[model samples]
Target: MRVGCPKEIKNHEYRVGLTPGAVREYVAHGHEVLIESAAGAGIGADDSAYIAAGARIVGSAKEIFEKSDMVVKVKEPQPQEWAQLREGQILYTYLHLAPDPEQTNGLLASGVTAIAYETVTDDRGGLPLLAPMSEVAGRLAIQAGATALQKANGGRGILLGGVPGAIPAKVAIIGGGVVGLHAAKMAVGLGADVTIIDRSLPRLRQLDDIFNGRVHTRYSTIGDLEEEVFAADLVIGAVLIPGAAAPKLVSREMLSGMKKGAVIVDVAIDQGGCFETSHATTHSEPTYEVDGIIHYCVANMPGAVPITSAHALNNATLQHGLALADRGLRAIAEDKHLRNGLNVHKGRITNHAVADALGHEVHAPENLLYVA
Candidate 1:
């Protein structure tokens, strides 16, 4: 099998799909790797490094898309890249298709077999492939929110960790999953007043034990969410619904009730956002004011630290990627967890969550592959 990796072209996105080490692993598996020129530049790997790893350096992304049996990428294909996708070719990447109708339509029109990393599951019912980036984004949310809280950034001019005799900023995290847990860790470490709201009582109890009373774990309710969010100096939207769009927990009316100059870092912006006012921003311009509340909704928050993001992402995805390269659709047919990652295959939506979210026709991956 020939696997191709093209340079990521999203705004300020520098992470590549495969590292030289990952390429070497593919070579060891008897797979030919084609990396587009400068594909690994984000992670500081050069063409010479890929060559040493037994990967051929292709001149352009066009050649890679045209020739490779499977295309590996860090982010979803942009308009031009999706245009190059051919029928029967495999695309393994993060396809947040629920919120992006344009991208969904493009993939369907291209007739490509698209496996989304975000929807991939593990036996523990955890999103293994999305965990690494979620961890990065979760930690980064605190940093970004802190910066946005500065007076110059249209925030309330309060320090996250207040000095003696000063009150610390209140941080409300709207989920208790991987992103929320890490965000809580960062906020608590900085001496902020942290409260995590979730509907899962058992998970809340687990978090309460983990924090040992340092962090407040609240049962999420409409009233509780309103109170916590309104009182918070910084609110981190970390809620997720797998392949579906994130629920809008903070509405526009609710934002108006929040403290003036409050900051909201929607870590769930990639799956649409938990804040009603949230819109995807780039690192160059990460925050905007909505109803006097600052919103830092960078869709690719992990991309801000490409070195860590790329290596972490590659570590989580390499094994599944190798499986696909070695056996193609047969890998998905055999692994139920990997099959959950199939969002689109041969012009049909394969994931139920994604299909329901986007109102698209659903097709079972096994049916499409004729696996039986």
Candidate 2:
């Protein structure tokens, strides 16, 4: 199998799909690897490094897209990139198609087999492929919110940790999943008063035990949500619903109840944000003010730290990628986890969550792939 990676072209997105080490792994698997020139530039791996890893460096993204049997990427294909896709080529990447009908249409029109990393599941029912980036984005949420809370950034001019004579800034995190847990870790580390709201009582109890009462864990109810969000100086939107678009937990009217100058870091922005006001922003322009509330909803929050995120992502994706490279469609048929990752295949939506979100008919992956 010939696998290819192209340089990411998203706004301020610096993460690479394949790193030198990952390329070496593919080479070790007896597969030919093609990396577009400077594809690994964001992760500081130059052409020489890829060459040393036994990867052939191609001159253009178009060449990589045209020749590779399977295209491995960090982010979803941009308009131009998606336009280049053709039938039979495998597109293994993060396809947040639930919120973007245009991209979904593009994939369908191209007749490409699209396997979304975000929907890939583990035996434990966890999103294994999305976990690494989620962890990175979760931690970055606190950092971004803290910066946005500065007075110069149109925030309330309060320090997140606060001084001995001053009160600490309050942080409300909605969700007790990987993102929320990591956000709470960072916020609490900064000495901010933190509260995590979730509908799962068992998960809330687990978090309370983990934090040992350091951070408040509240049951997510309308009154509780309003009280916590309104009182908080920073609110981190960390909710997720697998391949589906994130539920809009914070409405436009609710913004009026939040504290003026409050910061909202929607870590769920990739799946459309939990905040009603969120539209994808780039790192170049990360925050926008809405009703006196600051929204930091950069769609690719993990891209801000490409080195760490790229390596972490590579680690999680390595095994599944190897499976695809070795057996192609057969890999998906054999592995249920990888099959769950199949969002679109041969012009049809294969993932139920994505199909429902986009109002498309779902093609059963079982019907599409022959395990035998």
Candidate 2 versus the native: TM-score?
Answer: 0.99
Which tens-of-lDDT digit does each residue in 95-132 have in candidate 1? Answer: 99999999999999999999999999999999999999
Candidate 1 TM-score, true structure as reference:
0.99
Model 2 root mean square deviation, Cα atoms = 0.9
Clashes of 2: 0
- Whole-model Cα lDDT per candidate? 0.95, 0.94
Tell me the TM-score of each prediction against the true structure: 0.99, 0.99
Candidate 2 positional error at 258, Å: 1.3
Q: Which lDDT tens digits does candidate 2 get at residues 234-333?
A: 9999999999999999899999998999999999888999989999999999999999999998999899999999999999999999999999999999
lDDT of 2 at 113: 88
Highest lDDT model number: 1
Off by over 4 Å in 1: none
Clashing pairs in 1: none
